[model samples]
Each structure stands twice: as structure tokens, then as C-alpha cells.
Target: MFKTIKNDLPASIVVFFVALPLCLGIALASGAPLFSGLIAGIVGGIVVASISGSSIGVSGPAAGLAAIVLAAIVTLGGLENGGFEKFLVAVVLGGIIQILLGLARAGIIAYFFPSSVIKGMLTGIGIIIILKQIPYFFGMDKNPTGDFSFLQVEWDNLISGLLNSLNALLSGNISVGATVVGIIALGILLLWSNVLAKKAKIFQLIQGPLVAVVVGIIFFLVTQGGSLGLLKEQLVSVPVPDSFDSFKGQFSFPDFSAIGDKDVWVIAFTIAIVASLETLLCVEATDKLDPDKNVTPTNRELIAQGTGNIISGMIGGLPITQVIVRSSANIQSGGKSKMSAIIHGFFLLISVILIPTLLNKIPLSVLAAVLFIVGFKLAKPSTFANMYKLGWKQFVPFMATVLPMAITGDLLLGIGLGLAVGIFVILLKSFQNSHFLHKEGEDVNDGKVKMTLAEEVTFFNKGAILKELDNLPENSSLELDVSKTRYLDNDIIEILEDFAHKAKERNINITLVSERGTVENPPSYIEFFKLRPKAS
Candidate 1:
């Protein structure tokens, strides 16, 4: 772990900056107290990171959960009396369900997803991040929430906000001082590694995000005077606890009385499923990006995430999952082990406890600048180039997953659509090749019915194969040869069982042959067929 310090330390700083605003934003979106987001962020990082087996994956309060949290609060607490504390109870129950899933080893479901769909998911998320962060960057903060839908803003609200900004510009209500400093900070971030740092080699020691954040803080301080047109209110302001005890008092507990409510179970199950899926997907993607090409243990990761969520929820934190954005940043920043993830968690814990006031001094616009860069990196031109190079079979699913995710605001729904399309493609290939022929009695005979196995068969193949077997004429001689087959799935074997039962009704003779063996005896087909073990 110590050997990872060089990479992990820098990576931790990047994740810390990325996570800060998200914590606040997600909290704001969830209709929860602003401090709840910080609590979630702290727990997600420190608690989840400590337990997760993934070297590069980062866990946090996700934007994805904001909608659920908000809805649960509204429904369970009653619209007028809705309290965020009730929703916390649902999150705690969700964590318990997640732990059960991990013990059941259900994390292996992630392996069934195609690589194309996974790539599409990352690209879709990247696009959403870019679009959502634009308003924040431009200082337009009147939108309802950060839900990942393509729903348009209310026409009146959008027009009014634009007009308000325009009027503010004319009346000098806008902060020219903050805007100027933000531009300079963005410019420095864009060029620091390329121009200034190279020219002054010693400056290279500072990371870009650290520099940008530091410059932003200094700019806030320098422009705090009345003459500079920067108001203290314009800066990022987190709630400051008056003392250590006051800060500790902010922690919340789950209201287990609500656990008996059916609604609580529904929300809990939703969180468990979505959070687990997201964590598994992130784990897979992060492993792909790891320079060392290390493969994380998926089941172990599930266990870690489950443990994290249980802890996080118990302590008033939001549900935790392995987040792709932070994990990708970790990989890009040269993280070599889980130490980077663990350290970032510690950073979150330290920052909130020791420097809450200091954090409030940084500008929200500067944090937006950091996310803006990250969003762009995820949806870069090179990503498109690489996907296109893989051809339509890959690109179609990628787009099918991405486009819907961007439009519908549901990650799982989009991937489901993509998987549906992928399965259709496979079936088309299978149908085109579904033919078999054989020579019997020394030549082609009138009593022989040929059969062919689909290119690949699974449990889903049972119906089609069974249908064909049922249609065969009585007293017919059938030869089932799978010599040219690539995959003879287990579902097809079940279909064969159906065929055996029907053999007496049709008065049919059946023969089975493959690369390994041939079956002549009616009752010995299972023993006659020899299958090679599938390659791992």
C-alpha cells in the first residue's frame, strides 16, 4: 500500500474535488437537508472504500438515487410533513437487502452483460454529466433537480431565468469579479500541464485540480472586498457546525417503525437492485481501465459494497455504490491499488470534520469547472472513434443503450433495450443457419427428417427446438447432428428430453452424432454424446 502513495495521493485529491459538489448537489436534489449529502459522501468514501475489494472504484452518494430519495420522502412522510429522516430508514433497509444479495452471490449477474452494453453505459453517463453540469457552470441554478432525464425545462422558467441573467448583466447584479476569476481558473486548469508547468518544471509538482481549487479560494479571498463586486454569499457555503459536538450531533438514525410499511420495502428493494448493478458495472469498467489489468473479484466487491451501505445507512448516509466517474478519475490519475480509494475516503472525513468552514470558501463555479473537464474526458471524440471502429454489431447496442439512457433518465432501462437488440441479432444469425441434412440407407431417403442446432443455444432456445421436434412426422427417421455447431446449450439438452418422450408417440427413430460420438441406441443418447469443456 505504501508503494501506491505516489499515485494514490494525487488520485485521492482529484476524487475529493469531484465528490464535494456532487455530495451537495445530490443532497439538494433529494430534498434532504444539505448536510445529509455531506454525510453520505463521507460514509461512501471512508466506509465503502475501506471495505470494497476494487482498487480503483469509488463509492459515493449518487445522482441516480436522488429521485428515489426525494419520492420516498414525499410519499412516506406525507407531502406537507415529509421528513428526510423517514427516507433514511428506507436507505438502511435497502442496505440490509444489499448485504443479503452479496451473501447469495447474486453479483455474478453482472457477468451476463455484454461488453458493448457496458461501453455504451459509460458513454451515456458521460454525455449526461456534460449536459447537466452546463447550467451549474453558467450560474443557472433554478432547475428542479439533477435527475438524468432529457426532459426540457419549463418554457416559462427557462425564459425567465435567461431574462433575469440578461437583466442582471445590465444592472450589474452579476458578479464580474467571480466570473473573471472563474475564467482565469479554468484557463489555468486547461493549460497548466501543457504550457506554464512545462516552462517552469518545479510547478509540475502541483496537480491541476489542486491548483485550480487553490486559485479559486485565493480569488474568493482577494475579491471579498466591496470594491471587487464579489459577495460572500456567492461563494460555496456548507452549513458550519458551531463545535465538534454540534457537528457530531448532525448524524441521523433509521426509523425502523417504518420498516413495516410496504412502501419502505419497495424503496429498499429498488435501492438494493440499482445500487448493486451500478457497483458491479463500475467495478468491471474500472478494471478495464486499470493499467495493471487487474481483475477485481465481483462477489467480494458486492460483499464490500453491502457492508459499506449497512454502515453508511446506519450512520445517516445515503446508499453507496461504486461510482464510475470517480473510479475513472482514479485510473486516469495513475492509481495502482485500493489505497487511493481508501485515502480519498479519509480525505472526505477529514475535510468535513476539520475544515468545513474552509470548504465553504471555495466557489461552486470552480468545482463545476473540474466536473466539466471530467465529463468531457468521458465523452471524448476518441471514445466515439473507438466504438465506431468496432462496427455496427457493437455500435448499435452501444447507441441503443446510450440514447435511451440520455432520453429516459434510466440506466438499467437503456441497457435492457440494448441487450434486447443484441439478442435479436444473435437470433437472426441462428435462424439463418438452422438446417440439417443426412444420407440414410446409402442415399437421400424419403423417411428422413433433418435437424440443425442453433449457432448458440441457451435456456431461451428450448421453445423453438421443441416446436420443431413436435412437428416431425410419425415413423420418421431423424438424424440430429451437431458437428458444425459452435454452442449446443443446456436448454437444447432439455429439448432433447422432450424429443425422447415424443419418440413413442411419433414412432420415430432418432440418431445423435457430434464431433466426439454417435448415438445408435434409443435409451443411450445421453451417454453417447461427449461434450468438450468450454474454454474459460
Candidate 2:
């Protein structure tokens, strides 16, 4: 663990920068107190990281959960009572349910997802990140900076925001200094991995996000002295607690009184299911990005996320999950172990406590610069190339998942659509060639003993094959071939073996040649035949 810490610390800084805005942005979007986001971030990093089996995955408040949180608040809080505390109860219960799921080994659900679907999901998220950050990058902070779905914002509002921005520029309402800083930050970020960093060896020692943040602060300082059109309102400002005591007062406990409400349970189950699925997805993606090929145990990750959410809810934080943004940043920053994740959580805790004022001084545009880079990596050209190379079977699912996710507001819905398409293709292929044909008079004495495979040969194929064998005349030789079969599902293998035994009792000889394997019904019979491996 200590060795893991050495590699994780630097990566932790990168993840920390990536996570900060997301935490606040998700909270803002959810109509929850900003501190709730911070609390979730802290717990997700520290509590979850400490227990999670993942080496590179970073957990925190996710934008995906914002709608659920908002809806739960409205439904459980009774519009008048600010059911915010009741929502917190749901979060706690959700955590408990997640822990149960992990124990039940439900983490394998991640494996059920096709690789194309996962890639599409990542790409969809990348596009969303870029779009959402545009407003922040341009200094238009009126809208929440975390919405991934374009449908969430009306066309009129989008057009108006763009037109108003141009008007602001013409009317001299835009902060030229902030804009300059934002542009500079983006320039530095773009060049951080390029010639500038290579030429200036000193730049190699600093991360792009860290440098961008510092430059943003310096620009703010320079402009603050003269009030040169750059105002405090123009910068990113999280809620600053007046004192340590005031900060502690932000913590809210779950209202156990709401446990009796069926609505609360419904919200709780939703949270648990959504949060766990999201976390598992993040874990799988982070592992793919990890250079070491370290595989995180999904079950353990669920348990860790559950534990963190429980703690976060008890302390008045939003629901937590393994977040891909921070995890990807951690990987790109050379994170090697869970230590980076743990350190990032610690950073979130310490930053809010000791440097709240400085955090406020940092500009949103700078964070946008950081996120832009992260988004670019997720949707990089190489990603597209790799998916294409995987062939149409893979690419189809990838595009199906990506396009729908980009258009639809729901991640699961997009994936469900893609999976449906993939299954349909599979079924079509099965139906087209779902048969095993043996030549009439080649391997057998007569054409009467020829064998043909079932249209759908599952484990249940055993019964059908056995019944066919039972109908065969005694002392007859049969040629059973499954060369053109589309599916040689597992159950069929067992059935074939059972038929082999029955064939011996009837003094019947059988030859089995399939896409899977060759089986001579008589153990003493010897003939080589081609077979195909089972599907993964």
C-alpha cells in the first residue's frame, strides 16, 4: 500500500483537480447545498478509496445521479418540508443495498456489457463534458456546468446564451482579463504535453491542471487590484463557511422517520441500482486505461462505494459512485494504485478546510480548461480507430450506444438499445444457419441415419438429440455433423454426451462433428474432426 502511495500521490493531484468542479457542479445541478457535493467528494475519495478493490478508480458525486437526487428530494420531502433530509435517508439505504449486491456477487454485471457499448458510453460522456463546459469556458455561469445531455437545455436558451455572449462582448460587459486568462490556461493545457513542456524541462515537473489553476489565480490577483472589469462574481465561487464551526454545521443526518414511506424505498432502490451500475462501469473503464493491467474486483468496488455512500449520507453528502472523469485523469496522470484515489480524497478534505478562500479565488474557466483536455482524451481519434479495427460487429454496438446516448438523456436507455441491436444480430445469425447437416451416404451405411442439428441447440438440445437417437434403428451407423450450425450452445454438449451412452445401449454407432468438438458416440471409435470453441 505504501509503495502504491508513491505512484498515487501525483496522480491524486490530477484527479483532485478533475473532481472538484464535478462535485460542486453536480450538487448545483441537483438543487442541493454545495457542501453536500464536497462531503460526497471527501467521503468518496477517502472512505471509498480505503476499502475499494480498484487500484485506479476514483469515486465521487456523479452528474448521472443528479436527476435521481432531485426527484427523490421532491417526492420524499413533500414539496413543503424540504424532504432533503429524507432523501439523505434514501442514500443511506441505497448504500446498504449496494453492499448487499456486492456480497451477492452482482458485480459480474459489468462483464455482461459488451466492449462496444462501454466505449460508446465513454465517448458519449466525452461529448457531454465538452458541451457542458462550453458555457463555463466562455464565462457564462448562469447554467449548471455538469449537464451531459443537450436535450436538458432548450434550443432557445442555447441560442440566447450564445447571442447574449456576443452582445456582452460588443457592449464591453465581458471580462477581457478573465477571457485572456482562460485563453492562456487553454494554451498552457494544450501545450503541456507538447513542445513547450519538452523545451522547458521545468514544465515537466508540474501538471497541466495545476499550472492552469495557478495561472488563473495570478490573473485574478492582478485584476483584483485594479477592478479591471474582472469581478468576484466572474470567478468560480463555492459556498464558503464563515468558520470551522460553521463548516461543521453543514453536515445533515438522514431522517429515519421517512423510512416508512414506500416512495422513499423506491428512491432508495433506484439510487442503489444506478449508483452501483455507474461505479462498476467506471471501475471497468479505469482498469482498461491502467497501464499495469490491474483488474479491480467489481464486487469489492461495490462494497467500498456502498460504505462511502453510507458515511456520506450520514454526514449530509450527496450519493457517491466511482467517477470516470477522475479515474481517467488518475490514469493519464500515471496513477498506479488505489493510493492515488485515497490521497485525492484527502486533498478534497484538506483543501476545503485550509484553503477555502484560495479555492474561491480559482476561476471556473481554468477548471474548464482541465476538463476539456480530459474530454478530448475520452473521445480521442485513436479511440475511434481502435473501435473500427475491432470490426463491424463491435463498431455497430459502439455507434448504437454512442449516438443514442448523445441524443437521449439516459445512459442505461442508450446501452439497452445497443444491447438489443447486438442481440438481434446474434439471433439473426443463429436463425440463418442454426443447423448441422451430414452428407447422406458418406459416413453411414445408408442415407436413413443422417443427422441434422436443431435450429436452436441450447443445453436443451440434449433431449432432442437423445430423442432422435432413440428413433434410430438398431445396428445403424449415423453421421452427426454440425458444420453449418450458427449456435452450439453449452447445454447441447451435455446432451450429446448423454446420447453417446444411450447409443451404446442400443448397439448403435454415432459420429458427432460439430463447431464445438468431435465426439464419437462409441468411446473406442477414432476419427479426427473439426470443432469450434464456445463463445466467451
Candidate 3:
């Protein structure tokens, strides 16, 4: 652990800077106290990283869960009267549920989600992050950080909404200081990540987002109290405790009594299901990104995340998950082992304790600028075009997942819709290729009609095959072949037997072909099916 410090220590500094604003930003989004995000980040980095089998995964409060967290808070009736406390109860219970799932080895459930659906999920969240951050980009402070619903947050359409934001800026509704700092911050982030960071070791060691925040602080100090300076509301407001003794008082606890509430259990189950799924998916993606190509044990990852969430909720923190953005940053910044993640957590703890006042000066716009880049990277135009080229089978599901999530602001709904579309495509293909009809000896009406059954003919194909048998040409002879079939369904066998009985109605002669000998007048399908050595 100590040996990798050369690589891991510097990488941890970069990750620490990256995690700082995100922790605040995600908490800001979740409608929770800013310090809670820091707590989750610290616990994720320190507790989760220590236990997780993943070498490079960095856990933290996820932007993706902001919606769930917000909804849970609202459902419990806000922070008053043990509401937020009840939500913490859910988080704790959710952690236990995750532990149970890990014990049951349910991590394999991630494999069941289609690739297109998962990509669509990442892309949709990216788009959401972009949309949610736009208000901050222009220094518009009316909207909350986590709120992404177009129906609630902005105008009827995206263009009009952006135009409205521009109109607001023109009308002096913007914070000039924040806007200026944000632009420079975004410029630094792009310049460092795209150009200098890759070209020079020094730039790589010192991350872009860190520079952006520091520059934002200097900008705030230089411009504070001026005519165009940022308002107090426009900056980060991590509650500054008067003393270390008082700081301890800010931590919240769960209302164990709420464990009996039905709604509490519902939210707990939702958090467990969603958080665990997101973790598993992120584990798969992080493994693919690992330079050493190390395979993380998925079940163990669940146990670690479960433990992290339990600890985070016990004190005061938003729910946690394996965050892809931080994990990706860790890998890109030369993180080799879990020690980098562990160290970053310590940084989060130290920074909050020692410099809450200094950290509070960070302009929300600077963080918004940082997130805009993260958003664009995830939802680039190339992603959509690549999915398009994969053809409709893949593309349709991808779009189905993206469009609804983008519009409706619901992640689970978007995935559910995508899965429905994916299943539909599968069923359509099955319906199309259930059976095959071929022309053989001569004319279409007068000659042999050779019908071949697919290898596995299920009930879905019974209708198409039945239709073909009904339309058989009068005075025609037919050869129905099942030789290629491996497992014929009872439905198809019944259809064939019924067709054999009615062939004489059309003056049609029939011969049934299979691995068994040919039958001129076919016997009961059950008897014929029974003749196969292994068929039952």
C-alpha cells in the first residue's frame, strides 16, 4: 500500500479535488445539506475503497441518485418532523438489502441488461447532468442543482429554454462574477484535459478541475463586493460551524421508529435496487477501463457499497454508489490501487474540517462548468451515431432509453421502456422467422410445397405456421419437414397434426418428415413425437 504512493498519492490529490465539488454538487442536487455529500465522499473513498475488490473504482454520492434522494425526501415531508431522519432510516435499510443481495450473489443481474440499454442509461444521465447544469452556467440561481425535469425546471422545449436563459442574462438576471469565473474555469478544464494534461506529466499530476476551483476562489476574492460581483447565494454555502465541538452537532441521525413505516420500506427497497444495479453496471464499466485488466468480484463490490451506505447513513450523508466519473478520473490520473481512493477520502475529511470557510468560496458556476464537460463526454453526438450504425435492433432500444429519460426525467422508466422495445424486437424477429416455405417440384399451385420448421418453434410461431397450412393450394402435395428442428413445441406439433387431418379437405396429399422415418398419413403428433429416442 505504501509503495504505490508515488503514483497513488498524486492521483489521490487529483481525485480529491474532483470529488470535493462533486460531493457538494451532488448534495446540492439531492436537496440535502452540502456537508452530507462530503461525508458520503469520505466514507466512499475510505470505507468503500478499503473493502471493494475493485482496484480503481471510486465510490461517492451519485448524481444519478439525486432524483431518488430528492423524491424520498419529499415523500417523507421534508426535513421537518423527522422527515429527513426517516429517509436516513431508508438508506440504512437499503444498505442491509444490498448486503442480502450480495450474499445471494445477485450481482449477476447486471449481465441481464442489454448493452444498448446500459449505454443509453449512461448517455441519458449525461444529458440530464448537462441540462441540470445549464442554469448554473449562466449564473441562473432559481433552479436547484439536482432538478432535471424539463417540465418543471425550464420552458416547453430545450432551445426556447436556453434562449430564455440568454434573455435572463441580457436582463441582468445573471451573476457576472460567476459567469466570468465559469467561462475561465471551463476553458482551464478543457485546455488541461484535452491539450496539456496528456502532453506533460506536470499537467497530468495537477488536475484541471482543481485549478478551476482555485482560480474561482481567487476570482471571488478579487471581485467580492464590486457592482458585478457574485451574490452570496451564487457561491457554495457549506454550512460553516463555529467550532469543532459545534461541528459535531451538525451530524444527523435516523429515526429508527420509521422502520415500521410502509413508505420507508418502499423507499428503502427502491434505493437498494437502484443503487445496487448502478454499482454493478459501474463495476462492469470500470473493469473494462482498468489498465491491468483486473476483474473485480461483483458480489464483493455490493458488500462494500452496502457497508459504505450503512456507515454514511448512520452519521449524515446522502446514499452512495460506485460513481463512474470519479472512477474514470482515478484511472486517467494514474491510480494503480485502492490506496488512491482511500487517500482521497482522507483529503475530503481534512478539507472539510480545516477549510470549510475556504471551500465555501467556490462559485457554483465553476463546478457547473466542470460538470458540463463531464456531461458532454458522456453524451457526445458520436455516441448516438455509433448506436445508429448498429442497426434498429440495437439503435431502437438505445433511443427508446435515451429519449424518454431525457424528456420525462425518469431513469427507471426509460430503462423499462427500452427493455420493452428490446423484447418487442425479439418477438418480431421470432414472428417473422417461425417457419419457412419453399417451392420444389414445379408450379406454385400444382406442385410440391416443402415447409421447413425452425430449430426451436415455440408458441409464438404457431399462428404463422397455422396460417400457411390453412392457405395450402388445392390438389397440391406437401412435405412438412422438421428434420432440422431440435426441440419442437407441443403447440407446433398440434398444428402439424391438425393440418394433416384437414389436408384432404383441399385435396392435398401430405408427407411428414423428421429424424424419424417419413409417414404418409401422419400418426398422432404425441405418438410420433414419442418415437424420437429423447423427445417427450
Candidate 4:
């Protein structure tokens, strides 16, 4: 893992810049202390990256879990009565459940989702990330950089951030300092990626994101609260304690007293299910995005994530999941192996401990500019166009996943709806044609009916097979073909066996054909399938 440090180290710095604001933003969205997000990022980088088998995936506090965390914090108690601490218990328990799920091989659930749905999910998240950052990009987002939910709450309004952003643009209302810095920073990033990156090794090693951040700091000082200077609310803010001991006091412990509470388990299970699904989904998307095309071990990923969450929660952190944004950023920045992920997490930990005050001056808009590129790369117009050209079977589910997620800001809901659509399509196709059925003779009423089984017939094909068999007339020959079948489910085999027995009573001559030889009234196809064909 360390062998690629030459490549991974620069990538790690880029991921660190991308992850820092998000950790704080998602925590603010989750109604938790800003410090908790940092804790999760730290654990995710160090513990989870060390254990995970993924080469490019990164783990941290996820924005997708923000709403759940928000509600759970309120339910357990408010910050006044240790509500946040109580929620930590649920997080720890949730990690335990995730570990159990991994051990039980529930990670196979990741493979069940269709590729189209996963693609749509990636595109949708990209769109949402772009949409969420617009207000900050223009410096109209007057709130701290930590609140980046789609339903942004800025200037005392919940859903008005976007409108305000446009109005600000029209009315010449803007964060002049932030906008100027952001524009220059975006230009620099574009130059680096498009022009300078291939020009020399030093340009590749230096990285654009770190340079943008350094420029942002210098801009802050230059402006110095002048007419066009960035205000306090427009910058990244990491809570700084008065002293080392005070910093230690910010660390929170889980409240085990609430472990017996039923509500705790409810929240625990919810987080476990959502976080696991999110992690698995991200694994699929990130693996696809990897240029090297390395496949992640999903079960091992689950165990790593569970371990990260356990450590994060015990120390008062939000829930952890393998996040696509940071992972995608890592990949785009040329990260190799898991060392980059580990290093980024270390940067998060060390920055907060040593130079948080310096980090504070870094403009949110500059960070927004960095994320803007990440978001655009995720939801490029070509991606959407490609999906549309794939036909409705692929396009419909793709849009289904994108629209609801973009609108309601719920990741799982959109994925569930898209997956449901994909399954419904499968069911329809199964019902229409499990296999071809035709008459052997020209006259359908007087001729025998011949049935050919599909290559693989599962229980889903039972209805179609049953309908065709039941509709057959008495006193006619029925030829059942399974020559091409590789797998025949027990349910389908049972249906066929019962039909053969009934056909005999109806005076119908039922002919069976297969590599396993032929049988008129098969006692049990289950046994037939298990038996070897005769050596003749």
C-alpha cells in the first residue's frame, strides 16, 4: 500500500481538502457538534482504510445519514440532557449489527442491484452535489460552510437558498471576495487538470486543490474585511478550544444507560441498514469509476465500515459509510491503494489538532470551486445522454433514481424506487415469455403443443409455465424441452412434475427431452437434476 506514496500522497492531499468541509457540513446538517464529523473522518481514514480491501474507496461521516442522525439526536435528548451522547449508543450498536451482517454474508445484497440503477445513483448524487454547492459557489450562502443539505437552511429560510442565490446574482448581491477567489481558484484547477498536469511531474505532484486552499488563505488576509472581503460566515470553521485540556473535554462518550431503551435499538437498526446499503452502493459505484478496475471485497468492506462506526461512535462521532464523493475525488486525483485514504484521514486529524486556526481562514467558496469540478465530473451531460440512448429499459430506471433523489434528497428512497422499477420490468418479461410455446401442427385446436424452456428458469417463471400447461387440451401430445436449460429452480421443476402426472390422467401423452434423458411421468425432477446422466 505504501509503495504508491509518490502518487497516493498528492491524491491524499486533494481528498483531504475535499473531505474537510464536507465532514463539517454533514455534521451541521445532522444537528451534531462540528467536532463529531471530524472524529468520524479520522476513524474512517485510519481504521476503516486499514481494514477495507478496496483500493480507491474512502470512508467517513456520510451526508445521506444526516437526517437520521438529526432525528435520533432529538429523540434521545437534546444537547442539554446528553441527547447527543445517547445517540452515540445507537451508533455503536448499529456498528455491531453491521458486523453481524458482514459475517452473515449479507454483503451479497450489493450484487442484487442492477447496474443501471447504480449508475443513475451516481449521476443523481453528482447533480445534487452541484445543486447543493451553487449557493456557496456564489457566496450567497451566508451560513457556515458546514450546512450543505439540499434543503439548505440559510438566512432563516429552509428552501429559499436557491432563489436567494439567483436573486443575489440579479441584484448584484455577492460575496465579492469569495466570488473573486472562487473564480480564480476554479480557473487554476481547470488549468492544472487540463494543461499543467501533463506538462511536468512537479505540476502533477503539487496538485491544484492544495494550491487553491493556500491562495484562499492569502486572499482572506489581503482582503482583511475591506469592502469586498469575505465575512466570517463565508469561511471554513473548525471549533477551536481555549487550551489542550479544553480540547480533550470536547470528546464525548456513548451513554450506555440508554442501551436498554427500545428506541435506541430502533435507531441502531435503522442506521445499520441505511449505512450498510450506502456503503455497498458506494463500493459498486467507486469500483466502476476506478481506472484500474479493481473489484472491492464487499463483505470485507462491511466489516471495515462496521469497525469504523464503532470507533467513531464510542468517541462521539456521527455514523460512517464509504462515501462516493471523497472516493471519486480520490480516484480523479490519482490515488493508488488505500494509503491515500489513510493519509487524508490523518490530515483531517492533524489539522484540527495543530493548525485549526489557519484552516479557519480558508474560504468556503474556494472549497466549493473544488467540489464543483467533482460534481460536474460525476453528472456530465454525456452521462445522461448515454443513459437515454441505452433505451427505456435502462433509461427509465436511471431517471427514476435521479429525479426523486434530486428532489427529495433521500438516497435510499430513490434507489429503492429505481430497483423496484427494474424488478417490475423483469417480472413483466418473465410473465410474457418464460419460453416459446407453439403448436406442432398447423391447426392449433387439433395439434400437439411444444414447450421450450429458457436457459435459466427460476421461481419467477412459475406463473407463465403454469398458465401455459393449464391451458393445454386433453387428448393431445405435449412435448417439454429442457435441452438448453442450465438451471431449473425446484419450484419450476415441481410445477412441471405435477403437470406431467396430471397429463397422464387426462390421456395426454407428455414427451420430455433433456441431456438427462427422457421421462414420461417423472417422480421428481429434483432427483433427476441431482442424478448424473447415464454413460451411454
Best by lDDT: 4
Q: What is candidate 3's lDDT per residue for 379-430, written digit by digit as tens?
A: 8999999878756877998899999888766667888898788668756654
Q: TM-score ranking from best to worst?
A: 4, 2, 1, 3
Instruction: Say which prediction, candidate 1 or candidate 2, comes out ahead on lDDT.
Output: 2
Ranking, lDDT, top scorer first? 4, 3, 2, 1
**Higher lDDT: candidate 1 or 4?**
4
* Residue lDDT tens for model 2, 184-276: 999988888776667874665577778889989988887776744356655665677888789878778888987899998999899999998
How many clashes show up per model?
Answer: 0, 4, 1, 1
Candidate 3: where is the Cα deviation over 4 Å? 1-11, 28-31, 62-64, 71-78, 142-166, 169-172, 288-293, 332-334, 430-536
TM-score of each: 0.74, 0.77, 0.73, 0.80
Question: For model 3, what is the error of residue 12's alpha carbon versus the real structure, in angstroms, after optimal superposition?
Answer: 3.6
Kindly list the per-residue Cα lDDT of model 4 for residues 1-536, writing each as its tens digit. Answer: 87899989999999999899988888888889989999999999989999999999999997889988988889988788899999999999999999999998888777667667888888888887777777777788765554224535553332355567778899988877888999989999999999999899899999999999999899999989597688888899998888989899889999899999999999999999999999999998897688765668788998999999999999989999999999999999999899999999999999999999999999999998999899899899999898787567668888999888777667888899998987786565444343533434424767577777866665455445666777778788877877766655444665565666677777788777887678775676657765745332
Q: What range of 10 consecutive residues in model 1 has the weakest lDDT sum?
A: 434-443
Candidate 1 per-residue C-alpha lDDT over 331-385 given as tens digits, one digit per residue, 9 for 90 to 100 = 7766777788778878877888789889877776677677667777777878878
lDDT (0-100) at residue 282 of candidate 4? 94
Comparison by TM-score, 3 against 4, better one: 4
